[model samples]
Target: MKKISLILSLIFLSIGLLGCQQSGKEEELNKEISKSTQEITDKPTIIGEIVQIEGERFLVENKTEKLPDGRPDAVWFSTDEMESLKVGLIVSVWTNAIEDSYPQQANAKKIEINEY
Candidate 1:
């Protein structure tokens, strides 16, 4: 009975410590995100056109596609998220690349297409 009580107490103690550590890590992450948001919010944006469209993915090839400066050959994203992106359709996209996953996609957060 004493052994079982000791084991349960140790488990509870470990869980409590882990929970506290995770909460601290979460707060640290939130602070980092807030700092990053402030840095990017000051930058000017390129509101470019949708050059191509695919299933759940769209491309907004900026005119200066010559440089290796992180512009997409074809931007890709979800039509559900950016409702204006349909096949053979042109739309304006606001986005940035993940950097780690380069060339394959330039992920767009917002899209707007011209209506007739």
Candidate 2:
């Protein structure tokens, strides 16, 4: 009877340890998911001078930040807003991420010209 009880106790302890480890992994996954969600929600609004404008797409030199590679951060904008844009113009652009692209492109939702 004592041997049976010992085996049962070991089995229960093993299950408990497994459950704790699984819960720890789940919590870590949840934290990662939360961080990603926050990043998506916190997309930065870019304020920059228009460097180039080609048809419906334009490139802006972001004065407020730099890219990870130490290049002056440049954002690409695609919108009807191009009608009012000119090279050297300072503007604020509201944007959203383009899915599945390297150096990520943004779709400009609105553009407001800032008076110098």
Candidate 3:
């Protein structure tokens, strides 16, 4: 009877330890997920020259960095913030990412003209 009780206690202790470990892992996973979500939703800024403007969208050629594809980086902006923007004009754009697009498009939150 004593041996049976010891075995049962061991089994329960093992299960309790496993449950605690699993909950800790889950909490760590939740924290990592929250951090990743924050990064994805965070706004980013870009400084570049206007390559083209079609309606309210501006095609910008990034001056500060090249894209991962080894090509000069470009981004599209959607806003009425700067209506007088002309091609080759330098500007700084603040934007939020648009989901599910290649070359990564963003909706312009603000635009500043760096050149007159």
lDDT of each: 0.58, 0.77, 0.77
**Candidate 3, TM-score vs. the true structure?**
0.55
TM-score of each: 0.47, 0.55, 0.55
TM-score order, best first, reads: 2, 3, 1
Encode model 2's per-residue lDDT on 4-107: one tens digit a residue.
Answer: 99999999999999999999999999988875454333434678899888889888788768878787767787887566789999988775445344334777
Question: Model 2, stretches more than 4 Å misplaced?
Answer: 1-44, 99-103
**Candidate 1: clashing pairs of residues:** 56-77, 57-77, 58-75, 58-77, 59-75
Q: Cα lDDT for residue 112, model 1?
A: 63
lDDT of 1 by residue, 1-116 (tens): 99999999999999999999999999999988875454322232333456665676765554555447665454455446746455555555554433334334545555666453
lDDT of 3 by residue, 7-107 (tens): 99999999999999999999999988775454322334777899888887888887768868777777788886666788999988775445445445777
TM-score of 2: 0.55
- Residue 36, candidate 1: Cα error in Å is 11
Model 2 whole-model lDDT (C-alpha atoms) = 0.77
Predicted candidate 2, C-alpha RMSD:
6.8
